[model samples]
Target: MGNSTFVFVVFILVYLGMIFGRLPRLALDRTGIVVLGAIALLASGHASLEGGRSGIDVSTILLLFGFMVISAQFRLGGFYSEVSRRIAGLPVSPGALLGAVILVSGVLSALLTNDVVCLAMTPVLGRGCIRRGLNPLPFFLALACAANIGSALTLIGNPQNMLIGQYLNLSFGGYLVFAALPTAVSLLFLQGIVLLLFRGKFLLPMAAKEEPERPFNAWQTAKGGIILCTVVLLFLFTSLPRDLVALGAAGVLLLSRTMASRRTLDTVDWQLLALFLGLFVVNGAFEAAGGLEIMKDGLSRLGMSLASPSRLYGVTTVLSNLVSNVPAVMLLLPLVRDIPGAGYILAVSSTFAGNLLIVGSIANIIVAGEAERMGIPFDWKGHARVGVPVTLASLATGLACMVLI
Candidate 1:
């Protein structure tokens, strides 16, 4: 077969792994699949080893790694867990609690990465619900949905947004100007949909069990918070490169006198970094093989101009669920890279599209997995009941905001 056809085969296999979460009967997960695909392309002589190395976007990797370290600092410091514990301790009804969960998860997610927020908050919220005699399902769903919506609020909120911002050279303040309103409206829509769906159930308090949590470290938490604030200010006010500023912040955190760098680094999601690297190579080779141009022409013939913001929004939302958001964004980037306002459209649409189903985004998967481990039954059906409406409403809000802008 021709080189292009061989690359296409590998791409399809890799995406299948993404959709299934793993390859059947093969202990290979999504990360392993992409790594294998990159290897295959190199071996087939379709892409050289040097070309593959150059394809990996080091700046995106650095920025992602730096943010992961910052997130790790918060996780190790017990910041996320403590915040959730405090919110659950409030003397409020279940509906009020839902609102609090949405607000906290959303706001934190808007500041940090959504996956990290979900990873650190899921167990705390779940156990807190069980301890307070409230059902954990609604709160779990809220954490997942709200995190997805909230992550769209800023450029650094999630990986795909970061890619869009960096690739498009979008101004941090400029993108936020367009994204903030839709994100706020979506958050409100998420809160309302979750509240209306799980009303009264949140009020039934029944005590369950509690999991031992990490000791809250005031100093470490303070350090991470300070660094986070500085990084944000640098991103918003200064003209310095965001990746360099973020790496500097991560470096500062790595210099702790008490906490071992190993401990903080251990909290970093290395597998995710690997997945990004592998996809960069695999997708890069696929693009070099001329697959994207062929697909674009086919779509153009179908009257689908991906350069259009609205059309890009629709395709992004659908493709995100099909192969997960990161890869979908990678596939769509060449099509929309030059379109004005495409960054905001892609960021808001793909990130919010994650709420459509449990398998739609990594944040949802993390929340669901954490809940299941805590003995809470969080099935896809339960997620879809809330996910479907919240996704539709949030996307509607996003579309209206995009139109107004």
Candidate 2:
């Protein structure tokens, strides 16, 4: 086979590995697949070390790293736990709790990445529901769906948004103006779906519950809170590089005298960071092999311009479900050019698609993991009952907004 064909085959295998959650019969994960692909390209003289290094987008890496660090601070400080507890204690009805979960998830997701918010919030939410003698399933589902929907509101909400923002050079405020209404509407749609699907259960009275609480690390929470606020302000006001801002915040958090650097580092998902680096290199090489040009031409032939709202939304939704949103975004990035509303479309469609299936997003997987740890049964069928309809409804709303406004 030609070298191009060989590289293409390897790329397909790597993505397949990602789909199965790891490489077959190997103690390797998605990050490993990406790293292996990059190595294969280099070994076969398809790419060089300099090429690999150049392939990695430092801005994306820095932004991801900064968010991870900021997220770590929240995780360590027990802020998520506090928020969960406060929600649990609200005197409102179970329906209100459902609304609160979706609202909080959406709001926090716009600031922090959806996956991080879900990872930090799920366990606390699960435990809180159980303590209240409430079925944790609906609440947990709300958390997952809300995070996915809410992350669509801003450029920093998900990795796909960051890529779109950087690629399109979108202004933070402009993206928000275009996305905020759609995001809000999507959250309401999600809430309505959750209430209807689980109405019988959500309306039932809860048993008397112990006062819900978790160990609160005030110092850690404060540190995380400050860093998160600073990062937002930086994004809004200063012209400093986004990634550098995130990395610098992470550095400050890591140097905390109260928390060991090792502990802070341990909280960081090194695997996730590696996955980004690996995908960067692999996708970079794929783009260099004329695959991207072929894709652009094919898409153009199909009359699907990435700049078109309806087309972009349709393509992003299908691709997100097909390969998972992150990888799908990486594949589609080459086809997207600087356009007025491309960032909003990319962020909205990619994120909302995550709500379509159990396997659709990393946040869903994290929620599932937490469910398993808590001895809660969570399966694809169960999730799809809420997931599929909510996803479709939100997607329709988002797409309509994109097309109409």
Candidate 3:
């Protein structure tokens, strides 16, 4: 086969691995599969490490890595555990607690990466519910759904948004202007749907057995909080490059006396960063092989070129559900260049689409994994019951906001 054909075969097989979440009997996960694909392209002399670095968008990687470190600081400081305790410690009813879970998870997710928020908060929320004699299922679903919706509130909220914002030159404030209303509305819609669905099932006959989690340290939390806030302000107010700003903030956190850098770095999602790098390399080679152009031509012939924001939105949602959002966004990004308001379309659609299925986003997966480990029965059916309606409502709100903008 020719270069384009070889790239197409490797790309398709790689995405198949992504969909399946592993290789058949190979013990290779999505990142490993992507790394293998990149290596394959390199072996064929169709790509290079330098080309991958360029394709990876070094600034975006830096920004993502910096935030991972900041998130690590919070995780190690036990800030997320404190927040969960405070929420559970309240003298609130089940409905009120549900609303709080939705709102808090959403807002924190809007500020931090949704995956990190879910990873840190899931255990605390789950065990808190156990201690309270409340069934944790609804709350766990709420956390996952709200995190997904909330992550759309800002470009920094999720990886795909970061990639879209950095590569598209989207204004942070401008994107927020478009995203704020929809994300807020999506949170409200999610809260209502979850409350209504789980109203009668919010309690168990008895609280499940609970266990103690990581302890909170006030000084460590305060140190991390200061650095996080500074990073956010700099992102909003200054013209300085965001990657550098975020990286600098992360570096400061590494200087902490109590929390060792090794502990903080341990919380970083190195697998995710590697996944990004591998996708960048493989995707670069695929593009160079004219695969994107070929797909564009094929889509254009189908009257579905990405220049139409609506078509792009629809396609993004479908592909995100099929292969997960990050890979879907990477696949579509090249075609969206110069397309009006494509940034908003990609960000809004891909994010809300994640609520459609458990496997659609990492936040959802994190919550589910935690539930299983805690011996709570969380299944695709339970997730879909909430995910389907929340996803529909979120997409509707996002579409209206996009139209108004």
Candidate 3 local lDDT, residue 170: 86
Cα distance off (Å), candidate 2, residue 172? 1.3
**Clashing residue pairs in candidate 1, if any?**
133-206
Location of the lowest summed lDDT over 10 successive residues in candidate 3: 47-56
Q: Please, what are the lDDT tens digits per residue for candidate 1 over residues 171-228?
A: 9988888889988888888888887887767754555666688778999999999999
Q: What is the lDDT of candidate 2?
A: 0.81
Q: Which lDDT tens digits does candidate 2 get at residues 1-405? A: 897897788888888887776876899877788888878887887766683443777788778777877877887778888888788778788898999999998998888888888887887777677766788889989999999888888888888788777766678877788888888988898888888888787532344334444477988898788888888888888777777888899888888767788877787778777777777777877777888888778888988778777788788887787678988888877667656656667777889899888888989989988887777778888899999998888878887786677
The runs of at least 3 residues in candidate 3 whose Cα sits more than 4 Å from the true structure, single-residue gaps closed, are 51-54
**lDDT scores in order:** 0.86, 0.81, 0.88
Report how far residue 303 has shifted in candidate 1, in Å.
1.2
- In terms of lDDT, the poorest run of 10 residues in model 2 is 203-212
lDDT score, candidate 2, position 361? 90
TM-score of decoy 3? 0.97
lDDT of 2 at 320: 81
Q: Write the per-residue lDDT of candidate 3 for residues 294-330, one digit (tens) a residue.
A: 8888998999978776677789888999899999999
| Ranked by TM-score, top first | 3, 1, 2
Worst 10 residues of 1 by lDDT: 46-55
